[model samples]
Target: MKKKLLLVLSILLNSYLLSAQIFTVNNIQYNVISTNEVEIITYLGSDTNIEIPNTAESNNITYQVVKIKNGAFYQKGLTSASIPSSIVTIESGAFSSNQLTSVFISNGVLTIGSDAFSNNSLTSISLPNSITFIGDSAFANNVITNIDIPDNVISLGKYAFVSNLLETVVLGANLENIGESAFNNNSISEIVIPNKVTTIKKNAFSSNSIENITIGSGVTNIEEGAFLYNPVVNVTSLSTTPANLPLSAFDNNFNISLTIPENTSEVYANAGWVDFGSVNGETLELETFIIDEIEYSIINLGLRHVEIENYYGSSIDLVLPSEVVHEGSTYKITEIGDLVFKNKNLSSVILPNNLTRIGYDSFSHNNLLTITIPDNVYTIDSYAFKDNQLISVNLSSKVNYIGNEAFSENVLTNVLIPNDVKIIGNAAFYDNSIRTLTIGSSVQKIGSYAFHSNKITNVTIPDNVITISNLAFYGNKIKNLIIGNGLKTIGVSAFNNNLLRTVIIPENVKSIEYFAFDNNPVSEVFCKSSKPFLYNDLFANKNNIDLTIPADSYYAYNDSYWIGFKSITDGTDLIDTTINQIPGLLLISNHGTISNNLQEYVSLKIYNTKGQQVLNNNLNGIYIVVANDSLGNMVVKKMYVQ
Candidate 1:
């Protein structure tokens, strides 16, 4: 009898706490957990548009309204709602039966409960980066045009986006599961599952208009009807072994075309993949060849052309083959495809003598120390050698394009751009240690952020480039910069945050954007253009910049925004912004002398007043010496050399 009474008391206490947590404030009912924590349980007012406050005052206590409970806004007269960042969870059926056309999820939301936005009229929704779990039927029956799953999402619940009119679906990099009917009845055209996905549950992507799909290597299972009712035309698998694809997984779509890796054809063909239309691997007959004990997969573009896709086995110096023989047929290897040697610890690579092109990310994120591009190559695709320890690279004269971020984040000290290059793509050499760069004469443009945050001390842009895009040299240690005459525009923040002391703007430069030299220590400008276009804040923070204009146009510089500088002078005594702004005259002994402050050796020369060199020699106390280097940074001493 005593035990039964205690149980009944426990139940009654829970009931009392539940009642105490529920309260009404301004005709709106909320559920309170603590004195300072609450959730919107239901709306008692008749407001059509609601701006949910991040925090509220309740009975002299400040409460954070963190959640919208189940059925809180059901059948409400709400047309729009502004969720605050403090709200982390949207409970089941929270916004159902509302005439909502647009809903914004704030940045701190972590979970969307089951059916949270189901049956709503949302046309577009941007899932915040903090979203991790999307519950069942969370966004079903919407008109979402495109969806980009954030990288933090790990799982999609069953029927998550069912019946949506989604035209595009971009999967995140960390998604691991596709729950039952997750994307059913959509209009998605293509999908490339992230490399970490391990499963596709029942009918996950069914009833879609998907034309192509790429299954990542980590996928181990495709449950029955996972892709049912989709007219998938092509499938590509990055797996070396045949994955378990049940006959009903594809709904036995007989019109599918599948492409597996070179050696997995037989395993895929025997696993019911041959039933699909035109298995290319079964008929094309891939051939492998050995080069210095390393094996490579060569795809015959025809009898005369070939591509080396994947190479196995590593040597300190990898030497590719010029010709590959397979099945008694000879094909000349011509190109390297995407990610051909990515993530490898290769120290060096020797291209074939007849190689013509290297594709995207071909040698990215490797341990290569040096590379010599063949003379016949025409293109170096994006991310070709990014995130490496590469110290040296020799480009071929025939190359025309250096793609985006081609050699980013490397330790390269110098680069000699080939004379045939026409375009330098965005972020081509960002965050590198390239102290010396030689832009070729044939280049037409330097893309955005092309040399951002580099160690370059001096550079000379050739006359062929017409534009230097925004932030091209935003954060560098550059001391000297020479713009060519063919340039038409200098983009926004192009030369911000440098150690520049002088600038020479060519006569053909038509426009310069704001913050082009925001934080530079510019003292003089030799501008040749009489009335070149200049914008506000061109020299944002540094007020000591001096603009030296052409003799013919003093009014143009003194009247417009160019007058904001520290001073304006004539271009007749124009200054050159060389790194050797400070005189480096020093005293060195006749004996062997190392730098007293880790300085590099400067040139020792004696020159006559007519620009004629009288003597140039090593450090000796025999003659008065002058100094200059390639970067115009010299460590000179007034020592006589014998």
Candidate 2:
């Protein structure tokens, strides 16, 4: 009897534990553990006020109320309600189309689904700091006047707040990025995007009545259409110092004055000109932007007074005021701006005593017969002395940089470059009549077309020159070339149309750039060392010419490649005698045709004055008919009738 009693007690305890919080109405037991919360499933009547209980239980079994599913309370009567802290999530359309005056999102909730509060009567909202995300169209079509986003929210989905009656938008400091159309078509008059929020998505504020925007400084790139159709005016002055104004940053807007700060120099494509007027007068004042630690003044426009500080004129033998100081320290203007004297007719100019820099086009098109550039001058800007009748130019020892077209079209027979110059700009000496070129050893880069189309007959490139740009010596009458050992890159068309019969590229040359020696009459090439000199069409097709590459570089040659003639040194054992044999007698007929005269049974060898056989073959003697002047009369000679 005792064992049966213990078993009954155990069974009773198990049944009691299983029926915890079970509901019973009129003694009818109903399981409440699995029943969903009483979601205002569909409001039968337009009740003014509504409430949802935490639990609906008839028997003793409790369930956890987690969410209000979508459309649960569509068109409900409640003007506003505070969601209980136990609610963790709200599904899409849960409270949509309701007369919800406002929503108090408690801290326990994690998500608000799409259209959850859409088409509601909420005037504004302050999201709980614990909410992480709001889905698309969650608060769209609502009467929310302003929104204070939660600090913990990471992103806002597209159309999340579209058509809301918003006056100001305060983004969360912890927000990383915003999605497209997050706040479209709102009455957002002012917004302060935090520096931590790096991006503003496209169409985020489009068609809004946004009249003012203050972009933060930390943003790098403004993406396409970020602020499209905004009513903001005078955007440049919005920030004390705006950063990274990209191209079209201010497009499709109107502004009065654009004041580029002293710290800002680069104005990217069309960013500051939103239908701006042509030639807006400016008074630029920059400070402490010193190169080589020399302070200079840009402009000192007096207040409310238009001062034409400097005049650019076309005068002969013009002398600038000694008070003008540009670029560096000593009050002598060192540099001039672009097109300062582009088409002037200055014959002989004596620079001001303290003047240092000659700006771009300072003395271009001047028929200057002679000029003595002072030693204090350093930089000669582009086209400074171009298209002049300069028979001689004495550059100062302190001059370092010679700009492009500096001495082009001059009549200088010879020029001595000092060791201080490190670079020569493009077309610096083009069209000059200099017969000899002596580049300084300190010069490293020769710019494009530097000495092109000149009467230079010989050149000894300095060992320090590493790069020779394209067309450097094109159309030159150079008969001798002494390329330096340190030369590495020879640019395209460097020696085009030259009369060079032989060229010796030094062993230190690594790469010969494209078309470096094209259209030149270079008959022979001798590379000093076995290190390969890459020659692709270096000697393209002078059929009657000879090329003698290094003995070890014979493996780099192609038989069918049209390097027409070869003269390899005897030191190269790689030469196969059969392939090295000359074809036949090179009959130099008056018509310039190469042929052979041969008797099939007889073998003959023909050699020129250099002890190299021109033709060696067994053939019948061939006759190439040639017409020449014999005793002042036209005569035909069968010269090679062997």
Summarize candidate 2's per-residue lDDT along 556-620 as a digit string, tens digits. Answer: 33332423454454234433323423222234433323343322211334444344545433323
> Which one wins on lDDT?
1
Q: After superposition, how far is residue 606 of candidate 1 from its true place, in Å?
A: 62
Residue 617, candidate 1: alpha-carbon lDDT = 40
Note the Cα lDDT for every prediction shown: 0.74, 0.60
RMSD of each: 25.6, 30.4
TM-scores for every predicted model? 0.45, 0.43
Residue-level lDDT for 173 in candidate 1: 91
- Could you say which candidate leads in TM-score? 1
> What clash count goes with each model?
7, 29
